[model samples]
Target: MNTITDTSIESITIEAADPDATREFLAAAFGLGGRIRVRRSEAPTTGFRGFTVSLIVAQPSTVHSLVGTALAAGAVEIKPVAKSMWGVGGTVQAPDGTVWKVATSAKKDTGPATREVEKVVILLGAEDVGASKRFYLDRGFTVDKSFGSYVEFETPGSPIGLGLYRRRALAKDAGVDESGSGSHRVVISGPAGTDPDGFAWEPNPSEQ
Candidate 1:
């Protein structure tokens, strides 16, 4: 009955000649205005030399607009930004060719499970899990489970989960190599009684 497989867009990577300049410009233009992590990477001896990848808080409803504006300003659009039926997302590419994507989330709670799930978790992969944990923890994220190769942040009233893990393992899980360095975007949905899937909110008491 199903023909297409694996339709969700998880992550992406891009190459930039001047990663720092591009990062600063993008952060300002997109109003990311959050704690950003910068890492120096080598290899892929073609497009990138020294670069920075920024991970910002993303919500599903406005993820597309956030990325679209940045891409339109200075970032190049590699993949056409779009949303999915299950309320996930895929928006990648930025100026300097740095890749960024809005976070994608799981399907609706179709089971008899009531109680109204308010949020979802987002997971990311990093080379140094410990360092990354400290980085996020310093930025006001409530860190949990510090023994494994991964770390998670519990953000409620969202559709996607927020987490970080080992880059090699993350790439392996996604069937990709972890040698390249670039920005990635992710989106999480909003709480109930709100526009979880829809956007452009006003004072809509009827929808609420």
Candidate 2:
């Protein structure tokens, strides 16, 4: 995936009972209510670019915990918890019911240890070493030391070494077939033409 520095937003989604609540949640979250409108609704609705809404609920107790959390945060509750046609859930009045989801999830974290892992430098493949350097330089990226034929670019807060590699070579390192020279081309876009390609990725607004 090509990631740009200062890319603003990528996607927006909403989920709610009244559509209006979804929109209002998004409005408060992104502060884009006055300008962009791209929400798709079965009824009257609204949308915002780079927004995504995902609604998931499990047991009634789980839903209550989520609702309680929201209420504790001073969020206005619209309805009491009850069993709906779908399952147990409740509707909350938001600035835009049609914008974002105001529900809880039935998921858990049963994975590995939650130890911190920093920096996610994207690996870009390049053909010409000098040309690739020049391309990145022209785009304002400061190149790290050149290792053999491969070159590196710095992305703030990235934990690993982010660099440009020979497509075939990197593929071999990752145990992927990279025999074809022109197999892949990774583009690192920056804001405007001045912003350098940085390796910072934030949480998607819709998920938040």
Candidate 3:
């Protein structure tokens, strides 16, 4: 059995065909902080095939603002802003092929939710949901919710929620090609500082 430790995603590294452009888009759209690292890659990227980076906001207004910002930054809208079972949300694809979902929970609805951003979720599209679920479970992530082909896990003291979804299905939902190839442009970290399931880890230089 693998011992679990307090873990959190340190950063998500995106290998973009045009790193500077990708970085500018992200900054303009989401005001991406130091947590996101963008690097140039000559190697072809399959684009956002099997993953979504979600921004959880405190209110519906923020969701609208984020969606608009993404569009202004050259993102293609996959889903327009609308009310869903969870709350009001929308989806967009970044120029670098990264899919982003901006949403807020209905529970926070109180005569107009505030515009404060809450959390970020990195949802990974796994070739095998069960295998990916187990990989994180063994590494000490506690399951928050689980259903067929979908699972959500939360790390201790980490605001980010990691999720696993069926790859082809996720790609279909994002309105993107189901082809899974090239660098995934993602990174996860934890207190253990150990790589599981062949995931790479780069310690935060500032934290060191």
Reference-based lDDT, each prediction: 0.42, 0.40, 0.73
Residue lDDT tens for model 2, 103-144: 333233333322121222345445455665675666456776
**Residue 157, model 1: Cα distance from true site in angstroms:** 16
2 or 3, greater by TM-score: 3
RMSD of 1: 15.8
lDDT tens readout by residue for model 1, 113-187: 222223323355666778666655654557656547866665443333456657676554333345654323222
Worst 10 residues of 2 by lDDT: 181-190
Task: Between candidates 1 and 3, name the one with more favorable TM-score.
Answer: 3
Query: Residue 159 lDDT in model 3?
Result: 49
Best by lDDT: 3
Q: Which stretches of candidate 1 lie above 4 Å from their native place?
A: 1-24, 27-29, 34-61, 82-86, 96-98, 104-150, 154-162, 169-177, 181-208
Question: Rank order by TM-score, top first?
Answer: 3, 1, 2
